[model samples]
Target: MTPTSSLKLTWSSALESGDRATDVQHKYLIEIINELAEAIETGKAGQSIRKILNLLKQYTDWHFCREELCMERRQCPAAAANKEAHKHFMRTFDAFAEEYKVSGGSEDIAMRMYKTLTDWLVMHIQKIDTNLASCPDNGCSR
Candidate 1:
């Protein structure tokens, strides 16, 4: 789906690292976040929210593993910190998901989650993930 202004997230060149696979995954994550927002805004988020959250969690797990493997193999000095950051993100996301479940999918809660996801993603990609470009392979191709 095309990301609309209502999603409050727009991809920018600043988020790119010139790595095709990682860049594509990052963009997909953004789209998933936007999809979550759309589901909430459209009042289709009861069961759908759970599904979307699961999709996000699973994707996160896969992406982190893939990144960590590449980083470790390439001897990236930032690997440890990068893994920590990913773990922290997962923990934070889990907390939010639990809160949403407890609140019975409150709209306010959804918006809060949306904002958190959007902000965290943009910052993490720009600040943390960009460092992946410095790996021994120069693009984490290892």
Candidate 2:
């Protein structure tokens, strides 16, 4: 794999979910992903990669909780599906984390993480998260 410094993953505006807070979170995730890519490329990741992975794990869980709360509050029709998707993503993430621990941030693990954070995350924000924007009050109601 190419050096992490050589790789650049920028956040595209097209990934926005139309909710300011959600959008901010998504952008931060993109930033973290870029950091991970850089770490991998520079061969400096080591335990740093584990920290990033832990950050990702925590952030995703927190974000999913917020999203699910929004979905529930809005009485969104997609709530069930959204919850399922969140569960699935958490499971996938846990498995990846385990693999990373076993592999020690190998190139393959880096590639997998890059894909998950960039491609999968963008798709989820654009497709699934965007649905929340359709709700009244932008799904922020208590």
CA lDDT, every prediction? 0.80, 0.74
TM values, all candidates: 0.87, 0.84
TM-score of model 2 (CA atoms): 0.84
lDDT (tens digit, per residue) of candidate 1 on 105-133 = 87777888888888888998888778767
Best by lDDT: 1
Clashes found in each candidate (C-alpha, N, C closer than 3 A): 0, 2
Candidate 1: residue 80 lDDT (0-100) = 90
lDDT of 2 by residue, 91-111 (tens): 887888788888766777877
Best by TM-score: 1
